[model samples]
Target: MTVLSSSSSRFPYAKGSDGTRRLGYGADYNPEQWPREVWEEDVRLMREAGVNIVSLAIFSWARLQPTAETWEFGWLDDVMDLLHAGGIGVDLATATASPPPWLTAAHPEILPVTASGATVWPGARQHWRPTSPVFRDHALRLVRKLASRYADHPALVAWHVNNELGCHNVYDYSDDAARAFRVWLRRRYEHLDALNHAWATAFWSQRYSDWEQILPPRLAASHPNPTQQLDFKRFSSDALKNHLRAERDILRELTPHTPVTTNFMVMGGTKGMDYADWADEVDFVANDHYVVHGPRDEGARDRDELSFSANLTGALARRRPWFLMEHSTSAVNWQPVNLPKKFGELARDSLLHVAHGADAVCFFQWRQSAAGAEKYHSAMVPHAGADSDVFRSVVELGRTLEALAPLAGSEREPARVAVLFDWDSWWAAEHDSHPTARLDYHTEALAWYAALLRLGVRADVVPAHGTELDGYDLVIAPVLHMVPQTLAKRLTRYVETGGHLVTTYFSGIVDEHDHVWLGGHPGALRELLGIRIEEFGPLADEDTVGVDAGPAGELTGDLWSDRVDVTAPDVEVLARYRTGTYAARPAVTRRAAGRGTAAYVSTRLGVDGLAALLPELLAPAGVTSELPECARGAVEPVVRRDADHRYLFLVNRTDTPVDVPGVEGEVLAGPAVRADGRLSLPPRAVAVLRGPNR
Candidate 1:
């Protein structure tokens, strides 16, 4: 049995106060909603769960600033005192959840104007204009005031700036936004001619003689061009960033020691704000992961997606532990069919988040509400109290976490492989007018990611630009459409020096300006990949192409199909389409570089194709993908390790019983692959298998 740590003791989280590994729950406790007696019960429950951290002041803007200038802290004081007394660290929010009703009445500009030129009202939260200077001025004041008040508080561990920036309808299309957009475009294009050239305005007789002609591209009239639509997405992302930076800068000034992070939605192409760029401003990254396994348990819907998102955040965070900012303890109110968490699914889901580099696991709310939008949402204490199943699961998981602090701080070093994930390219590629509208960048990356995950190979998603690729034995660039010249040279060096580099279709088609690279398909990669594309064709929705992808027989897929010319003599054809006009031709080919090789996947195939491709690719580099049979009905398993410790996480997304291997006299649990060879897992449960004693 794990002994619980006292709340008054120093935080047991190992990655320093702000480095990475930290454990806590996202506290949405509001004593203002309940009586003072209820607040005491909330603390006891949190202590039971071993939740050392809590996110406070979120959605309390209306409560704190009930009137124009009157801010109330009497209720907040009691709540904070109780949490600290219970030994819970606080990630204080600025309480700007929704601008106070009085602020909106006094200053209508604080409200956002939607794309349709309609000004949104104050009832709903997150409707404030991000780019409005007035909003910034007021938001900064609130943050400064809050920081000054809580800067010295020992309970304050971090700062969560504003609840989900840009989560509502796109705002601020008034004159101010138009003016800012014009300024942003000028800085980007430098001159009218360059802007016209990049936007290809000459072809449509849409030449902008003056910068003012660029009226933010879609307020009065929606974007006509695909590239412009993409740029608008990028611009919107920047607008969101500008809002966040305003608060982040102020908070850093008040408390430079504490880390600050805004919750980022995973598997999303946040238009203008690149997560990579955002990382520089944040001390660490945190994302809200809500996994929903649908009713009747046909299949696991949200579990794998959440884990993938966690991994993506971890990759961007550089293996630093991330916080699970928000996850559902039970059924979410917003979903069409609100299904409660299956038995053990909540704990399994939480473990899954931790397995994929989460230091803290926090649910959206701590107390179930009788009113409000999220009232139906589950919490630590349900509307029915501790008798509920959700409360039991929270208590059980909490007790387990208190004993796992040493494991929490440990890092997850991926196996010798890296996946190039570029936010800029994702933004750019979606906006491009490719023949196929179903070009899913997230799905494509997941194809490779899922393959790596199943193999139990640790993969890190690094920016395509300037990230070190020296140590990775194999680097896979999936649909890398925008290639930085510097990255091209690096890839060339990697391939030339006997390092393996793999790129898929649409790999290197454009430069940073979104300009097509002249003279063939995979622009800069042609010389290294030893292939040039003469003509490319898009497959119809019902269409399918077959390729003999090595051991995996006849891989098939729709959407992307390619034809290429093998220019390098040393290149070997690995697989080719067995059907079509280009029948019996090479679909997957590899070129022998000095001591290494570069493989080109000319088409996008399904999961089976990836399973086949990775083995052939990783084998030459001496990398192995483990295929352990999951206990029946269990979701797929994932494993990550530190230098001498291995953490095996198995998720039981299915309703039926599943078996996982158990650990005995071992450092951790799950299957053990010794110097010899062996593997097995007990039942639906997850195991953290530790390595041999050094």
Candidate 2:
């Protein structure tokens, strides 16, 4: 057997024993969906496109195991052998993404129930409850078998544990979930009194005397207890994580050398499963993202969404290059209305992921499915075959990736700005009983991040809790609703020692258990911010408040407004409410503590409002933009550097051409370039420039 050794690249790519570094291309290979004759053609096209890697057996559980005891590996063995002979490596899945019909039919109790008490039928993918012990036993059995069979396979380079775990059924409110929730709560709160107190059950006469009385937050009378719902979200995420760990453990014991990973849906539709906490369990992080459509104005919003998803995924991987496991070659079938990409969008989007630290780029499937729910989804081999525009773009992207292979292990330029994005806070802040139902955690954070991106400042979307803040000069936390005491202390020290902070409304209001910190609102950060919120004045959906910033002129904000009372004389009011019952009160304030500064924004400032405010907020931290001021909002510049060279990725998100000045470099990719200090970027074009590290 030819043993494939791993690469020393900072990014995780499958390596071979010959010490060759190969870029991972191609897509999910579902040979089971096609006949044996088509498999050879698939391999032929893959080689023609410069493809080197393909994920196999992702949803083949039913075919791999036809019965309770009977197992079949004949087809998979043939496929693997064919791929190896074709010079392609395999990211072999354990085929545990979905259970066989027999298993689900035999143990219907393992199926998941929704919050409304409706059973999610097993016809769809990921239909089983995460905490089902019966399901785990069967899943582990299949995983052990696959691991032992493929441990020594020459084509096997990595193990894909499952296909997007918890994508469809993240939360299960069944009786089994109720019992598991009780156990998870016991481990969390230790005693019943602590759990009751933390949940504040005394208000509703819902205090539990025994652990058995506790249940998953199901349909409740009014709203379920906030902390109970919070813990349940944690529990659900941990449950899926435990399943991943189970499969990971089996694979490690059997094939210690091969790396293991699972695809994560880190896009806008995802919630519940915290990928940050799940990052360590996988050898490398893999993510699936699709361009969100339905907006009337699509170009800029889609670019921002893709950039945000890619940057967040890279940060979750600790700035290490991760994998773009799934993205559409054209229109995705799952949106409200699927819109196909324009002429240059395929290469633009793929290279955009590479710019944001993705080492590998793969799609959903190699060929367009003739049947199934995703039949209309685009693939490398589109319905038009190899002569089509999509296929030509796929082949072009393969060649581009080959040219960019020298950048495999490179990292994104160190970001001086960091945005705090906490999944726990995302769940807690968006709970039913919040001050405003319109306050979305990710939307708020994305507003701030988008503003920074417009300013041409690269920012890392980092976790709120347990992330080190020493390296960042500016930290922005928008609507950080669940700031624990430890995180509060870390932020305070970060500001006191010279880091600048800008946090928005509803922040620092609770501990880890969703218990409010007494005294005034903005609880733990009151001293650092030098302001106390006496009351929260949530706005109606249509209502807007005017903020007067003196020289910066008036700005409009909505969704939430806090009645701020300045507590310290040193705190300067940057902006005030121009009209309202709280007119002339502070809407934005900044305080200097020790050597650093902390600023508090008391309302939801839309993108334009933040764009107006970021200049003053960033000036104190000595952070400035790399692009010309004229090109600030028109073009987005992202820099990634290695030991030898710096690569500048300039993306023009506008419809008209934009000229970026003072950027002199050798053109590495994109359209025509001249040796002058300025480059004109076409509409929706992406330019990759290589220059000296200075």
Candidate 3:
């Protein structure tokens, strides 16, 4: 990921062969995996599937340069020309995603070292360490060669910097990383004394007299210092960003006209990279998102999580169109139980990304592998070939994207309500020695999203840091634990300037250094929220706390609860603990500040609980669903706008048919509109409606 700065002159989008700009629809084309005869068939199938672009040579390092002294460009040259002739553009990769066996055998030290001192060998991809100068030198050499070779190719539409970086090798405990960490620390904090103060070394008898003493938070006898762990996380992400800068610089210098971008893994447990910080480095933000399976949830919940990820990615791109680099056409091989996508799930999922502001929708691969670790993974052409249902859906999705060519470069319309996701807080809040180990920061945020979906409220999930708070009327910051003085002041100013705020438990507890705000619990926000918490009353796994919201029904809360006391004169206690250790205490409170108001929830309210409480909190601000009452919860609404009209995407998040009344617009995709101006969508289907921009 690159730094989080706005790029005003980003490449608008990739144009089609007919000299018209259109939404990119394709997959990662790995022609190196098949015979030369297969290449001709691949291009034929690609055309039949309506694929305009293919990201080529992502992991062809070994075959591209077989040995140190050898260069094999004939096969790649033919493929590039063939794709160009077939009217398919190529997002050419530098082919440096993985180190060649010869290079690794010569310089094994470039391999990453785990916290436990185990070397990560070269059997898998992304084996090289980010801080290894040896690895960087070799990678940059390859990048320069690829860029110089493809600089004049007509098929080269964009430069794929490298495959998903830091996916497998984010955390490295080698000597290279240690030296880089010190350099990053010096750049961040010029003096050792400043570093000592920020890390609070006095507590652990770990005060550093010199810069060399500091190391990554590697495996140790007991729990490492909290601040050390947090800094290491920051440093690791920066290390990867520096490498991306290195690759991007070479590509820019060689092919000054080509736009360079690297894929970011923004889904599930991949928290090592700060994507918002890396947004500005590329020409266009590209993200690789796969629906995480397992205990998280399934079906509609899974789609909600996907929508959450796409929403955050759109925010990272500053609401401009972004590239959906990689997703599945059917099942992914990685998850424990690989579940194949149902009938309409494939097209439904892709359109959801487009609705959230993706201008390009691509899958993991073009063809299913004959032999590889991902043979079971689905592709545009499945193992059963193009005659299968998966490929049929691929063709249908391509037609849909073509019909959506009119909305290609449209920006994502701003939602009145926004959810702020903080990477720093996510890193610090989950560190060891917290009040409760069961506290999951993202789960709490996703719960809020699920609640918002149930209420049919459209909200953009934006990065918490450096966000334009004035753009949104209501902002929800969940588990905002690492609040620095700057953020505190910014949030205060936002509320004072008539911005409605809703924050949950465990927020505003610490500063940027992971140091507790000394006064009391929920530190920095205590004054603004007009409430004080003495201590955290975390419940056992099976225990539950009954909260009474007066007129609303009683709801159950688990995992965490706080003992709150009102400090402001006009603060209102919206809910009370009906049954708990501190029975009848304030469980939720709100206070008027300036023209707006701030509210706090002290318990871990699941999706249903929060949904039950949102209406009252939102009424005063006049923030209600724009959708009609009959279609509210059953359909998820997302809007995109251009100079003329706004496109409304109505996604059915249910298994049964849903009728959305009062939907008046021309249908560009999916079923036709009813005579009564109602939208009757099939299960797992998406309908795009174009209406006059309001």
Residues 1-694, model 1: lDDT tens digits: 0011112212224454556544565455666788778778778777776677788888887787777678777777777778888878888888875787778888888777766778888776876876678877877878887888888887877888887666674446776777778888888879888888887787667888887777654443433665565566667778878777888888888888877878877643333456666665566677776654445442333554566677767766666567778877888887787888767667777777777777788887888899988889888778988887888888878765654555676555664787887776776677635757778776677678666755556566666764677778898998898886877888999888878998998878887767788899889788889998877767878888888877766787567778878999999898988876567778898999888899998778865578667788887788764434444224455555556666655554455544444332243433353433333433445555554434
Give the local distance difference test score of model 1.
0.71
- The TM-score values for the models, in the order shown, are 0.89, 0.96, 0.98
CA lDDT, candidate 1, residue 133: 81
lDDT scores of the candidates, listed in order? 0.71, 0.86, 0.89
- Which is the better candidate, 1 or 3, if ranked by TM-score? 3
The candidate, 1 or 2, that scores higher on TM-score is 2
Q: List the residue pairs that clash in candidate 2.
A: none
Cα deviation at 74, candidate 2, in Å, is 1.1
TM-score of model 3 relative to the true fold?
Answer: 0.98
1-694 per-residue lDDT for model 2 (tens digits): 0001223323447333566555678799999999899999999999999988899999999999999989889999999999999989898998888888999899998899999899988787988999999999999999999999989999988889888988888999999899888888889889889988889899878988888888888997789888889999999999999999999999999998888899998888588799888887888888989888746753366777788889888777766678898998999998888899987788778888888888889998899999999999999998889999999999988987877766666778768898988898898888897778888887788888888877877787777765778889999998888888788888999999999999999999988988888999899898889999988999998899999976667989899899999999989899999977678999999999988999999988887788788888898899988789889878777778778889888888777888887877778777657567788888778888888887
Q: If candidate 2 were superposed on the true structure by all CA atoms, what would the RMSD be?
A: 3.4
